[model samples]
Target: MVEKVDLLIKNGYVVTMDKEGRLFKNGAVAVSGNRIVAVDKTSSIEQKYSAERVIDATGKIVMPGIVVSHCHTHGQASMGMPAEVEMENFYDELAKWWWPFLEDQLKKEDVYALAKYAITEIAKNGVTTVDDVMEAPKDLPGVLDAEGKAFLEVGMRGILAFEATERISKENGKLGIQENVNFIKKWNDKPDALLRGVMCVHTVFSCSPEMLKEVKELADKYNAWINLHVEESMYEVEYSKKHFGKLPFEHLRDIGFLGPNVLAAQCVNTSDKEIKILKEYDVKVSHNIQTNMVIGVGLAPVPKMIDEGITVSLGNDGFYLDMFETIRTVYITHKGVLKDQSVLPPKKVLEMATIDGARAVGLENDIGSLEVGKKADIIVVDLNEPVPLNNSNIYGNIVSFGMGKNVKYTIIDGKIVVENQKVLTVDEEKVRKEAYDATVRIWTRNGFL
Candidate 1:
C-alpha cells in the first residue's frame, strides 16, 4: 500500500547532515504530521508516498534548517546602541552600555515586541531553532512569559532562559532565578510546545558561587538545560581568580555546575587546561564568531576543541540573525587565524551549524538532520544563480556564496513558517514598527536619544 504523507519536497539537491554526511541529487523529503517520514530520490519518494502538499524544489538546495545555539532575545530592538557607547573593550561595553540599558530602560513590552521581531527575522533566514537568553531584570515578573508569547506568535522553536546574575543586586538575581524557574515549569512539558524554557546563570563573574550552586540544583531538580557564558573575556577569568582563587571554568567545575546539559557560550579565553576540563565534563560550547570579533576579544581555539572531541556549535550571539553569514565567517575566520586553508572545511562548518547545534541543545535525534522520524525542520535554498550547485561543489557554494536571503522556504515541524522569503506566522511590518517604536522609547528613557 502507498503511504500518505502531509508534505513532499521534491527535485532538489538534498544535503542530509546525517551521521554519514549523505547528499542526494534529485532528492525529496516526505513528511507526516510534524515528523519526516522519508528522504530519498525524487522518483522513489514519488512512487511510494502521495503527499497532501508538494513543493517542487527545482534548482534549489534542500537541507536541514539552521540551528542557532546562543543569542539574546532582548537585544533585537537595542542592537545598535552598543556601537554608540564608545567602548574601548569588552568590559567597557558591558559595564558602560549593556548592563545599564538592561537594568534601567528595558520594559516588558519591549521584550515581547523585540522577541517577535527577532524571531520573524530568524525564521525568514531559515533558522528553525534558537537558544535565547533573555535579560531585563527590572521587568522580571512576566518578562520570560512575554518573550514566550512572542515565540509562540512567531511560530519558531526556541529554548528560552532568563539570565540570572548578581551584577545588579542579590534580590535582582533572585528575581532572575524566579523568572527562569517559573518559565521552565510553565512550558517545559507542554504538549506540542515549540518554545521551551531552560536555566541560565549569566556568567561566572556576575554569579556568586552560592548562586551557581543553587542554579545547578534548580536545573537538576527540573532536569532542565543550562546555558551561560564561560570565560568570554580576560576580565572574567581575572575576576574569578581574584574572588574565588580559581579560573571561571575551574570554579564552575569545582562547584559541580559543569555537565553534559550545560551549554557554555564563548570560550574565547579558555586555556588548554580549561579546555580539557570542558572535555572532561562533557560540556558543550557555543562559538559566536562575529560577536567575539566585534567586541575585540581573542579568537576561540575551535579547531583544537573539535580535535579534542568537544562539541562546538555555531551561534550568532544576537550580532546578526543570518546563520549563512555566521557559517561563512566560521569557515574563513579560522583559516585566516591559523593561516591554513585546510582547517574547518565547509562540511564540518555546516555540521556545526546543524547537527552539532542540535546536539548542543540535547535535541539531536529530533531536529538536526533530514532523516526519518526527525522533526520536519528543513529549508529550501534557491540556487538559480549562474553557478551550478552539484554534489562535488555543494558545500563550497553554500558556505562561500549562500546568503540568508537565498532561502525560499523554511519548514518547521512540517509546517511552512516562511515561504518565498516571507514569514507566515506574524505580520512582519507590524512587528518591525513595534520594534522600532519600542527601541525609540527605550533609547529615550535610557538617555541615548
Candidate 2:
C-alpha cells in the first residue's frame, strides 16, 4: 500500500542535522500536511509514499531551514540610518539616542510593515524560524498583534515578545509587560501554534529585580520561554558591579531567574564564572557575533561557553538579516579571536544555527532537524559553486560557499512559502516599499531625518 503525502522533495544531498548527523547523497523527504512523513534514500521514499507536489532537488542540498534565535524586526527599516560617525559610542548610539528616539517613535503600523519586510528577507535567506523581541513601548497594549501579522504574512514560525523594562517609567514598563501577556494569551495559549509568544526584559539595568521576577512568574504561569539581553554591553557589566555587587549572570542566579527556559541573548562581557553559572542553569545563549564586534563590545567567550557545556546559538541581530553571513562569521570569528582554527568548526557553527538555535528557543523537538514526526521546515540550496560537494566536504563546502540567494526553495510547515527564489506568501516588493515608507514616517516624526 502506498502512503500519500502532500509534498515530495527528492534527488538531493540531504543534511538531516540530526543528532547522528546523517547525510545522504541521494535523499528524499516526504511531507504530509505539516509534518515530515519520511526522510531516507530517494528510492525508499518514492516506493513507500506518493506525493501531490514534487520538487526535484537535483544538484542541490536539502536541509533544515535556518533558525534565528534573536532579532528586533522593528529595526529592519532603520538599517543604515543615523550616520555612524556622529555617535560617540555604542551607549550613546543605542541607549541615549537610538532606543529613546527610534523605538519610541515606532507606531503600530511601523511594526507590521518593518517586521514583514525583515521576515520576508530572512525567509528568502532560508530562515524558517525566529525569536524576535519587539521594543516599542509607545505602541503598547496591542502592538504585538502588529508584528504577529507580519509573521503571518511572511508565513514564518516565530516566538514574539515585547521587551518589558522600566528605563522610561514603571508605568511604561507595566504596559510593556501587559503587551507580552496579551500576546501570549491570544497566540500561545493553544497547542501547536505556528506563531507563539514569550516574555522578555530589555536588560539587567533596564528592569528592576522585582520586574525581572515578575516577568519570570508570567513565563512560568504560561509555561512559556523567557528571553533577554544579558551583559550585552560593558555598561551592563559595570552596572552589575556598581549596583548589585556581583556579575549580571550571578545576580540572575541569586535571584532564581536563570533557568532552562531563559534564553540569554548576548553575554559579550561575561567571565568564566558567569559561563559556569549559565551552564549550571542550562540557560541557552544567542550569539550575535557581527553586532558585538561592530558595536565595539568585547567578543563573547563563545569558545569558552561551548567548552563549559553551555549551548550557544547564532542570531543575526537584525544587522545583515542574513543567516549565511552569520554562520560563516561564527565559523571564522572565534578562530580569529582565539587564534585557533580547530575551535568552532563548520559543523559546530552550522549546528549553532540550526538544532542548537531551536533548543535556545525551546523548539528543538519540533522544527530543528529533518526527521520523521517533525515539522517540515526545510530549504533547498543550489550548489552553483565550482567546488565539488561530496560526503567528506559537504559541511565545509556549504558553510564556506552557501549563499541564501541561491536557495531555490524554502518550505515552511509543509507549505511552499518561497519557491524558485520568489516568495509566495506575500508580495515581496510591496512589503519592501511599505517598510521604506514606515521608516520614513518614524524618522520624520522623531525629527531624525
Model 1 segments more than 4 A misplaced:
82-88
Instruction: Provide the lowest-lDDT 10-residue window in model 2.
Output: 82-91
TM-score of 2: 0.98
lDDT for each residue of candidate 1 in 234-293, tens digit (9 for 90 to 100): 989899899989999899999999999999999999999988998999999999989898
Return the clash pairs for model 1, or none: none
For candidate 1, the per-residue lDDT at 224 reads: 92
In candidate 1, what residue range of length 10 has the lowest lDDT sum? Answer: 76-85
lDDT (10s digit) by residue, model 2, range 357-429: 9999998999889999999999999969877678889998888878889898999988999988899999888
